[model samples]
Target: MTNNSTCNPLLLGNQLCFPLYASARKIVAAYNPFLKEIGLTYPQYVTMMVLWEEKKITMHDLGKRLYLDSGTLTPVLKKLENMGYVTRSRKPEDERVVIVEITPEGQALREKAEKVPYAMGCLINRKGNLFTPEEVETLKKQLYRLIHALE
Candidate 1:
């Protein structure tokens, strides 16, 4: 067999998205155990993080911040509501709009969740320092740029 790189644009190694996708999956997986300890899944945890910061926001705004669509976000919100971590209600002025708010339970969870970032940072830097803090920041900025470009 002959190797001809030019002949195959479909090759996984030739695509930028493949590595980004793989790395995202791996990072999310790495967060699982830590998230599980707090009784939240990765998506729910991220949602709560935003709610924790904002205290309360419209469902539309929450979805935009998380880059998730209603189809995806609705179930997550529902689960959080069921878990008594959040509440969802229609906006009084606009019945079309929905709002999400964190409960006191959810607020209390923040103390436990506060350690997650430190733990993940330790894991990332554990094996001979996979990336320096500066490198990580640069990579994060670049990824956000890519996301913005795509949007």
Candidate 2:
């Protein structure tokens, strides 16, 4: 029987998972400077993504769209509200349901946020930016497939 344990020491760089995870983290960290300038974190940016697509949506719907739960979103929404970017309230039609709506301030912030993609584009340009567009597309597709498959 092959003694797999006798294989070469687990060189982190040689392991796809380690390097891949570190690379992802490093890239996300690279975005920190820019994101900080805009007062948003990675998770916050994702939340803005769905909110940008839908002017107003229920917390439940937002959670579903963002793959987040109330525990994660509640504070994020509160922060946005405190920043005057969004408004959260119980739905008049369904008091049981909470709704979130972006304000003019939020829309204006969206306009400001329009530059983030450009900023991120420049950072991803390392290695001639080989991993930027291509990998993003492929990874999104693969992750989507995995998410659906696992579901």
Candidate 3:
């Protein structure tokens, strides 16, 4: 067979996913110092955000919202439960259903977390605010479109 790797469309640099993957990792890593101070990993912080908004939600629903599977979420929930940030239990009406609720401690964390986004914003802006607000919105919209299309 003739060699064609030189002009292959599947070359790493030609893929759209590489930049998205790298940027996502960089963005999450940039939040580490702030998240570390609050005693949460990125995944836990996001899970907590959903709990903060909903107060209480079923495990399945929470997983759906977080785009996580129960296998992955179970451990995060356990750690949060152990940390006193959330309480997880079986639903009285449906034993098979697990419900996660934010405790007073988790609510307290919300107050401290209020500054995290602003801190991350400052970090990104310090790196030169590469995208204008409108551009950011456009990028988000486009990404959402791609996500939905993939889904």
Candidate 4:
């Protein structure tokens, strides 16, 4: 008689998505305090990033920039409107189209946020991480390029 045992344990290093997902969670959590001070959630912060780049855009354009659909952008935009950070209104010439414009408050908030990416960079660098600001921006460009290419 013989007995055999196997340990198919999934260790941290063995799981690819685990680290990526974990890192994202921790990074978002780290931004919580800062974002709270600025009246934003993770998604809203990303939304602000897009609006900061484009002064005014159609809802469709906003969705494209955020890689989200109306279902997602609609609610977030609504929240921003409630916060007086943005204005969502029907286009004057096209009743079917909604235009989103950043408000003065939103613009000011974005100015305040200019340092957020840098601060986040510092946090990531503290643990001997390989990502610096340049690497991070490059990576962002590459990922957005990939996203656009896929779409």
Candidate 2 residue lDDT tens string, 9-79: 67553465676578779978988888898899888877777888898999999998877889999999999
Q: Give the TM-score of candidate 2.
A: 0.81
Best by TM-score: 1
Model 3 local distance difference test score: 0.93
lDDT of 3 by residue, 1-151 (tens): 2257656778887678999999999999999999999999999999999999999999999998888899999999999999999999999998999999999999999999999999998988886777899998999999989977977
TM agreement with the true structure for every prediction: 0.93, 0.81, 0.91, 0.78
Candidate 4 segments whose C-alpha is farther than 4 A from its true place: 1-16, 132-138, 145-151
- Whole-model lDDT, model 2: 0.83
Stretches > 4 Å off in candidate 2? 1-20, 132-135
In model 4, the Cα lDDT at residue 132 comes to 68
User: Which model is ahead, 1 or 3, in terms of lDDT?
Assistant: 1
Shift of residue 107 alpha carbon in model 4, Å: 1.0
Least accurate 10 contiguous residues by lDDT in model 1: 1-10
Q: What lDDT score goes with residue 141 in model 3?
A: 99
Candidates in order have lDDT scores of 0.94, 0.83, 0.93, 0.85
What is candidate 4's lDDT per residue for 1-151, written digit by digit as tens? 1122223345555565687689779989999887887779989999988888898999998888778999988999999999999999998898999999999999999878887887877776787887666987998897677678879
Pick out the ten consecutive residues of candidate 4 with the lowest summed lDDT: 1-10
TM-score of model 4 vs. true structure: 0.78
Residue 86's lDDT within candidate 4 is 96
Give candidate 2's root-mean-square deviation (CA, Å).
3.4
Per-residue lDDT, model 3, residue 100, is: 98
In model 1, the Cα lDDT at residue 48 comes to 96
